[model samples]
Target chain A: MEQGIQIVSILIAGVIFYGGVGWLLDRWLGTMFWTPCGIIVGTALGVYWVVKKYGQAR
Target chain B: MGGFLIPLEGEWVSPGVHSFDSRPLFPGVLPDWVNGHLAQAVIGAALVIGFWLWVSRRQQIVPTKRQFVGEWLYDFVRNNISREALGPDYRKYHPYLLALFSFILVNNLFGEFFVFMFPTFSKIGYAYGLAVASWVLYNAAGIKRDGFGHYMKKMTLPEGVPIYMAWLIIPLEFLSNFIVRPFTLALRLFANLFAGHLVILVFVLGGTYLLTLKDNLFYNFSGGVSILFSFAIFALEIFIGALQAYIFTVLTAQYVHSSISEEH
Candidate 1:
């Protein structure tokens, strides 16, 4: 249960962190596309982090 | 059945988030700071402190009933939660773990009680406050145990990662550790209590509303059923309240353990 909550937090954190970056970039460049791209990338990275930290043999 | 036919004065409005809002217990006499949940929190704190004090006032070679209960609570948190989660260093943090468990459990049980039907944590601020405290404690412990720079590096840069992937991994690690931990911790507790209270409201109020629908025998029958189900839900709320308290305390211990441990 604790691990499950932590994993979820990581996923949300990833989206918020990278998505915020993407939004900032979009604002600077005046492009509408960067936000979605950032979210996708952020999610991918978040999943990767989860796998890296938790997926391996103990 | 005919006696139950009297109609309710107002429409049965299903409870929503607004249900959590507090009307001042004292309309104008009490200061603005004193509201239902705030008062409940204060009461909960007092109850926890008083109970512990009463239990610990006299040392016994054998044990009284009160002492037994107190010892059971202490041992439960110390052995089951802190020891199991924090390992050899658990004793260092036992007091904190015990306090947190008792405080939360009392406040949560408030929701099921008659006079104070609000779980203090259903208010998001209280949950966030506890989370922030835990966050600071764990991070500080980590930094204190390992040097600040070393801790930061260890937290952000995992072992066995490729050098080329450092850029990608660093930000993710930073966000996961620094940002997500507290956010999820608060949200999990807040959401559970908020939803649990809301569910109870729906069942009880809906059932009461149904009981007043005297025009239909079916409605009256189902209303009785709904009220009965609400009792079962009340029982569930109590169990969840205790479980959430345990879960929160255990996770806090785990975070502390991870922070101070040599291995991640």
Candidate 2:
């Protein structure tokens, strides 16, 4: 249950961060470029690095 | 069946349309009022289909003006997304990806045409289907690139990490990369389009609500402003809908690119 919660929590943050950045970039630059995609890949990689070393060990 | 009940005075029920307020508006179930979303979807689909049918029937290589416009948009997606993201092999994927992008772009923009203002992408199911298609392509491409064993390992392992870190990293990596990423893609598109539709709905509905107030000077003034704001939002929605579709397709293509790249 706790693990499930963690996964969901990570997802909420990912949505806000990725969607927020993409939206801001679109509003500012008036183009749908890599900002949204970058946020997704970046956050995905960051969590993978963090959890692989710390969370899974437990 | 759920088709028999239409409240003529208050609530109208339809397959895809729902009211914003969540109240049981149980009265006006007229065909004209209850099925707004489906009506819009049909009209939108018909317009695209009609345009294509007409264009294809009269297509020419000598550069008629209509053909030029069609070819321009077709080439835009092909070159920008298919060629750029997938490289030289993009020709094989161009048809599917191009259709996906244009279908979404048209459906999203269709909301601007009338009082029936629902962008099809705002429906989560459509976004989910599109996302799953991209997900399948990415994983399939990965498997094809590295073979099954290597693909799995590459996805779960980061380069230069300590061997002991595998315990923590693998699950997190697997979950984020393999499981949730596609869902986020779908939700992001769905939520943005959905919110945009909702804002338009509020503005239009606000105008209607204000106009319904007693026939006084203040009511008319407020109602006029509400109508103006709604029109402004409708215009913004046209741009936003196309932009969201473009963003969704480009990101999907990029994901496929990353999957097959040597850096992975």
Candidate 3:
């Protein structure tokens, strides 16, 4: 139950972090592609994080 | 806006977000932030402190009822939450864990049965304050256990990762660990309490309004049923309050464990 909340938090953090970056890059470079790209990459990173950290531990 | 529910004093006043607005106890004298919720939180703190002190006053060998109650509460946190998370180092963090559990539990309970039927944490500000405290506690625990530099490295980096991925991984870890953890913690507690209180208000307010409509048996019967059903909602709120307190404490312990543990 506890880890469930953390996992969801990590996923949201990924979106907020990279999505923010993507949004800034979009504004800077004047393009719309990087925003979605960043979101996908971020979600992948978050999944990797959850797998590496909580999966094998407890 | 579903304004049909309330038609009190010939004015339709729908129960919505305005239901959660904090009215100041003393409108002009004290600041708006120092409202009924703040008073409830203060009272809750006092109640928690007093209960612990009352229970732990004198020594007991076999154990008196009050001592047993205190011990039971202590062991619930110590064994189940702190020890379950932090292993041998659990004792170092048990005191904070105990206090966090009891404080949140008491404040959450304030919503159910009291002169002021409101949970202190329903206000997002109070939830954020508690989250910031938890954030500080976990980070400080990590820094104290390991040096700041080592703790940062462990928190951000995995056990084995290519140097090429540093740019991508570092920001992700930083956001997840530092920013989102506490944000979600506060959001979860605040949202649950706020929504639960709103639901109770919907039933009670709607029921009361409906019952007063002139000579309509259908409206009166439904209103009466809704009012009766609100008791069950109150019972559910009590359970959720206790569960949230448990979840919050356990998650804090988990974060502390993650921070101070050897492996990232």
Candidate 4:
């Protein structure tokens, strides 16, 4: 349960942080679709981080 | 069971977030700071302190029942939680871990107790306060052990990430470590206690309301059943209360361990 919570939190943190940045960049660049792309990228990165940090046998 | 669906004269509104409000125990006699939840916190602290004091005052080689229980709790926190999570250097943090566990356990159990029916952490502020304290402790420990520059690098920079990927990893690491850790810590505890108490309230209050329905045999019977089930919920709440305390303490220890460890 604790590991699950940590994973979900990391995913959420990734999406929020990167997605917010994407949204701002979209506004600056006069585009409208960067947010979702950012979220997807963020999620992949987040999962990689989790796998590296916690998924291995310690 | 279909007959139990008795139409009510008024809406049977379920208890909502407002149910967690901390009303003054005494309407006007005490100061405003003395509210139900605050009083419960004070009582919880007093209970923890008093219990430890009583146990520590009498050091028995052959322990009595009370002393045995007290020692068991201390050992559980010190050995099972702090030592397991913090590794070989766990002794320095045993006191904080034990205090945190005991204090949280008492406050969480307050909801189950007859006198104080509110868990203090349901207030959110208290949970955040504890989380911030843990946050500060871990970060300070890391910085103290490794200089501030080294600690920042260790925390925000991954061990094996390529230099090209540092842009993404750094921000994510920063947010995960510095921002999300404390936020999730506080929200996890506050949400669990708040939702747990709200569930009990729904059952108990709804059961009472159903029982009070006029001339409805099925509603009354179902209400009794609801109230009976609430006792089971109360048992689950107690388990969750203790489980959350352990989780919070262990996670804190893990965070501290991660902070002061040689590698991330």
Off by over 4 Å in 3: A1-6, A49-58, B1-9
Report the number of the highest-DockQ candidate.
Answer: 3
What would the per-residue lDDT of candidate 3 be over residues B157-229, giving only the tens digit for each residue? 7666678877777887788889999988899899999999999989987887777676788998898899999
Q: Report how large a share of the reference interface contacts model 2 reproduces.
A: 0.04
How well is each residue in B235-258 modelled by candidate 4, as lDDT tens digits?
999999999999899889888988
| Highest TM-score model number | 3
Task: Considering only chain B, report the TM-score of each candidate against the true chain B.
Answer: 0.94, 0.79, 0.94, 0.92
Clashes of each: 0, 16, 0, 0
Instruction: Sort candidate 2 into its docking category.
Output: incorrect
Best by lDDT: 4
**At residue B96, what lDDT does model 2 achieve?**
68
Can you give the DockQ of every candidate in the order shown? 0.62, 0.05, 0.65, 0.55
Model 3 accuracy (lDDT, Cα): 0.86
**How would the docking of model 3 be graded?**
medium
Better of 2 and 3 by TM-score: 3
- The CA lDDT of each predicted structure is 0.86, 0.69, 0.86, 0.87
State each candidate's chain A TM-score: 0.93, 0.58, 0.92, 0.85
Q: Please give the range of 10 consecutive residues that has the lowest summed lDDT in model 2 chain B.
A: B1-10
Q: Candidate 1 on B1-264: residue-level lDDT in tens?
A: 355445553666678988877778787898876887888888888988899999997979999999999999899898889989888888888888898899999999999998888899999999999999899989999999999999999888878778998898788778888887888779889999999999999888888788777588888788889999999999999999999999889989988987898876
lDDT tens per residue, model 1, A21-58: 99999999999988999999989988988898789887
